[model samples]
Target: MKLRIVHQTVYRYDRPVRNLVQSLRLTPSVFEGQRAHDWVIEVGGGIRGPGFRDGAGDWIEGWTVRGPTEEVTVAVTGRIETRDTAGVLRGHRELIHPLAYGRGTAATRADAALRELAASVTEAADSLDLAHRLSAAVSDAIAYAPGRTEFHTTAAEALAQGEGVCQDHAHALISVARLRGLPARYVSGYLQAAAAGEAHEAAHAWAEIHVDRLGWVGFDPANRCCPDERYVRLGSGLDASDAAPIRGIAAGQGAETLDVAVNVEDVERLQTQSQSQTQS
Candidate 1:
């Protein structure tokens, strides 16, 4: 599957500001299930930018704007290719070293519950399918609910209460993989839909396991399945904080507000001029 994405972000101010700086992870990442064919970003205001790579291998852009500015617009357009490979990822072959994704970040710490879960799950890994089975077990153990916590919430807390969102799911999975000496990374992306017939809103996130021969393979614990053509992977990192699509701080004292709008639809249908596109 191929997709074209448009993401727009705006900052509104009650009073004029002086300067601004931001970190952007908007650029799509190339991993096992997805490929970035072509991509570009456009800012419609007075903004200066530079590109850099972060510790997690995510493409980062430092953007800054100067003074008394009312608004700034950042638009990203791109084409991505997707494939399904449940067998390509060989998690059993790769043993975890304290190099890349194994190290837990300041925000994402493995609490007692998470450590206990990992210890119990991989203690008797007699088969190569332990990761998958453990992932499914986590999905079964927790329920996906919103308004339960903020973005900075911890995995141990979620697992203790048996509840969380995609971030918690990914965090738990990453910690478990690390405990078992397998490499795992956090993935943030836009899910086309929740389930086969369910409605999806906004953005979605998941996790990827590093297999020696297969490289990185993704598993959507929220959906209880491996990522396929339906998923359009955007960026990946050590945890959600490193992989967040957008984050920044603005100068001011009054309350600041943010508004974001995103539309991820199949451009093939719209371009092919199908009946559905015509109707839409």
Candidate 2:
């Protein structure tokens, strides 16, 4: 299937900021499931710095806005060809060892509740089955409630509350996976639409566990399934903040508000084979 995407983020400040700098992980991943045809990231009134691909295979670019300005917008437009890989991350190049993901960051640290959640999983035939069980466990533990948690809410906190959006689900799953002695990480990406007609304000988040013989496999506990062709992976890290598509700071203090819009649509319905693929 061919997909066209447009993602735009606008930041409005109460007062003009002195300067702004941002690191972007907006580019799509290079893997067997997807290929980028045309892609671009544009920042209004900003200068582009040198960019590079990190060891984790994510492209990072720096942008600086010499602002005494009150508003800044980052826009991304792209087209990509994607296929279903059954949530297996194949052909992705990265130097970081899977064991390295076992280390938990502040956002994914397992607390008593998270440990209990991990312990609740029954033994499975294999690690892959265990991974699926873990995913289902998380889905059952947390109800999908948007606006119930903030961006900085930790996995433990979300589990305590028993409700949150995709980020919380990702973090909670990562924490539980780590508690079970499996390597897991958070993934940031774009989904063609919300699952089950639920409303969403931004992109999407999911968890990836390294299963024996399967390498890295993704699971969307929020959606209760593995990522299929509708998902476009951007980057991965120990948790959401670490894999944030955009991270930045303003040189001077200024109250800020953010708005984001993302659209992913199938663009190749004309071809017979493509129509069948899209229908799937």
Quick one: best lDDT, which candidate? 2
Identify the runs in model 1 with alpha carbons over 4 angstroms from their true place. Answer: 13-15, 35-38, 53-56, 87-98, 122-128, 269-273, 276-280
Model 1, 1-280: lDDT tens digits are: 7777766777777776656778788876555656766687766555757787654556778778776576777777777876666624321223344357778875457777777777777454432366686687679767888878668887777787888898888888888877777778888877766766464666778888766545676888888888776677666778888778877776765355677776776666567788667789
Which tens-of-lDDT digit does each residue in 160-241 have in candidate 2? 9999999999999999999988999999998875667543446999999999998999999999999988899999999999
Q: What is the C-alpha RMSD of each candidate to the true structure, in Å?
A: 3.9, 3.5
Each prediction's whole-model lDDT (CA): 0.72, 0.92
lDDT of 1: 0.72
Task: Please give the distance, in angstroms, between residue 215's alpha carbon in candidate 1 and its true position after superposition.
Answer: 2.7
**For model 1, the run of ten residues with the poorest summed lDDT:** 87-96
Quantify how close model 2 is to the true structure by its C-alpha RMSD in Å: 3.5
TM-score between candidate 2 and the true structure: 0.94
Best-matching candidate per TM-score: 2
**After superposition, which runs of candidate 2 have C-alpha atoms over 4 Å from their true positions?**
197-201, 269-280
Error of 1 at 131 (Å): 1.8
Error of 2 at 237 (Å): 0.8
